[model samples]
Target: DAGITQSPRHKVTETGTPVTLRCHQTENHRYMYWYRQDPGHGLRLIHYSYGVKDTDKGEVSDGYSVSRSKTEDFLLTLESATSSQTSVYFCAISESSRSGNTGELFFGEGSRLTVL
Candidate 1:
């Protein structure tokens, strides 16, 4: 096992509501990322952290934020959610390889957030 799991496998909320999704990992790795996936589009990065207490925003970072004060946990928060954000959210971790990233990431099943 890659030692990763996302919480609230399923979530339902109304538009404009505040939502928080949790990502937990036990890989003891240095990189963690949060992404959203929707139809007709590839995985879009929302936010990511390079190490404990070290984080940065990503391409589609609007309406979202993240926190990582511990090595095994990362959290994503939607200040005011929207229907556009009602997509499947995934947490992934990259293992350092002498061979480079290899674009390989171990992902948690996913957290499906539905905003009505």
Candidate 2:
């Protein structure tokens, strides 16, 4: 719960429209991540940012994009909404995990998006 906040926690949009989700944190953590959760797929990473303006694509980043201009904020956007992208999106923050240590990720509640 590391002071993470997500906006527009619930949204419904039509296909082909643009959608954006905002994640704001006060923890000043170095790593921020975006993930989507769906039935049978658990949670899949969409994108992640390691530092200010430094980001990378993840396994499920086909239609998603992300940006981090500051340490406490991260944004995820879907260029064009699709039914397949309708899912619960989560924002997580974590520090580097070390060997033999249990790595923990603090996640925001969630942002649910529906594409109709």
Error of 1 at 53 (Å): 1.3
RMSD of each: 1.4, 2.1
Q: Which digits, one per residue and each the tens of the lDDT, describe model 2 over residues 6-91?
A: 98899999999999999999988788999999999999999998889999999999999998988999999999999999999999
Q: Per-model C-alpha lDDT, please? A: 0.92, 0.92
RMSD of 1: 1.4
Q: What lDDT tens digits, residue by residue, belong to model 1 across residues 6-71?
A: 998999999999999999998888889999999988799999998899999989999999999899
TM-score of 1: 0.93
Badly placed stretches (over 4 Å) of model 2 are 96-103
Runs of candidate 1 exceeding 4 Å displacement: 97-103
Best by lDDT: 1
TM-score of every candidate relative to the true structure: 0.93, 0.92
